[model samples]
Target: MTALPIHPDQRTPSDTSVPVSESFVSIQGEGKLTGVPSWFLRLAGCNLRCRWCDTPYASWEPESVSRPVDELCEEMRATGLRHAVLTGGEPMIFPQLLPLTERLHRMGVHITIETAGTVTRPGVRCHLMSLSPKLANSTPVGDPRDPSGKWAERHEHRRLNFASLNELIAGSPDRQIKFVVTGPDDLPEIESVLARVDGWKPDDIILMPEGVTVPDPDEVAWVVEACRTRGWRYGDRLHIRLFGDTKGT
Candidate 1:
């Protein structure tokens, strides 16, 4: 499945492009579309540095190779897959994504954008807007991943943009809001944030346990109970379990 949707890859510098991390055909491991077969386009570069970001290859040190969107579209057409996931270190950061998503959608591909909900691009179309809003737990404060404590400060400042978050939710009816929950303490912050954001029902929210490896039984039970009590959905990273966090799954 080289034909599956993925970040653009270019042959020449003249080609219009976005930095590509990788691409793969895999079951969606998280969010509302969990267990769905989907092609993933992992674009590189992220504005925020989360302490537990699984794909540091795509975020902390993104691929330097800029890939052509036109080439990617050609491959996508050949894949014969209806679902195309435009994921990234943060796909919304690339304006080139407008054309990329437009072409894929026009090809009759059901586009699903996996974004952190910090950025928004108007005029983009997708069947599903899988918004994984970074919570306070994502801040890299004092985490060894950011040894200099540089990204720690910057990540905290850029993690949440309510203006963009609201726009993403308000613009799409077929969208899911997800938050990675680290512990029971994260519950109150989620409640407070949702109260401020516009246009989402309790059912629209999804609470995901934070881990790449199989989470402990206690964590799973806690998240399930949290969802049961709050009218939210529980999200799991099935791909991680199925593929062991490896690339091109």
Candidate 2:
């Protein structure tokens, strides 16, 4: 992978214990496994901060609770669920996920790693590599979320790592490129991002409406239309619709 000057805080803490924000049993709300029942392992800490980050507790001001992989795996086994999602605050930052997924795979659990596609995990094994690359709109330039008003530049520079994204795409046998589209014009930017990343198929691309809560119907329709015209899949924030963006499904 090519070198990039990622900010110190942007990198996951190189500690033995995996930092967990929250873990729960929720339906697969996005991508191909939209309605399937699955266990969500929402790890804490993120490299980049999004302007409209839905899980601010896991990112903007992360709630860190150290939990070991064995303990986390035990929680998954207790769930009695077959499908599992290793999601984040950018889960890729936490290397413990590599071993965590490894353990889950041995237990016959189908794992999905939801990431921003900025960090590459060569040994990361999963049934699905859900890649959600943050777009330009996600930058917190003048956003109040960033108290120092510095993440705009920091996040913008660290957000899109094509080299790492390409490695991640190449490593995973099954993968999806999910983009959180906030406007109609984001299509071009999305297309441009796809061009830089190598070996992504048309079916692997998914477009999700950008919002913490339920998005406007008109906004959702535009995303649907974009998907129809481009032959990409439309991803819905079902959790937001059903639970109104609350924690733990």
Among all candidates shown, the one with the greatest lDDT = 2
**Each prediction's Cα RMSD?**
5.1, 5.1
Q: For candidate 1, write residues 99-147 as lDDT tens digits.
A: 7876786688888888898997776767777888788888888887788
Each prediction's whole-model lDDT (CA): 0.81, 0.83
Query: Residue 209 in model 2: shift from native, Å?
Result: 1.1
The segments of candidate 2 whose C-alpha lies over 4 angstroms from its true place after superposition are 1-16
Error of 2 at 65 (Å): 1.5
Q: So what's the TM-score on candidate 2?
A: 0.90
TM-score of every prediction relative to native: 0.90, 0.90
Query: Taking the candidates one at a time, how many backbone clashes does each contain?
Result: 4, 0
User: Which segments of candidate 1 are over 4 A away from where they belong?
Assistant: 1-14
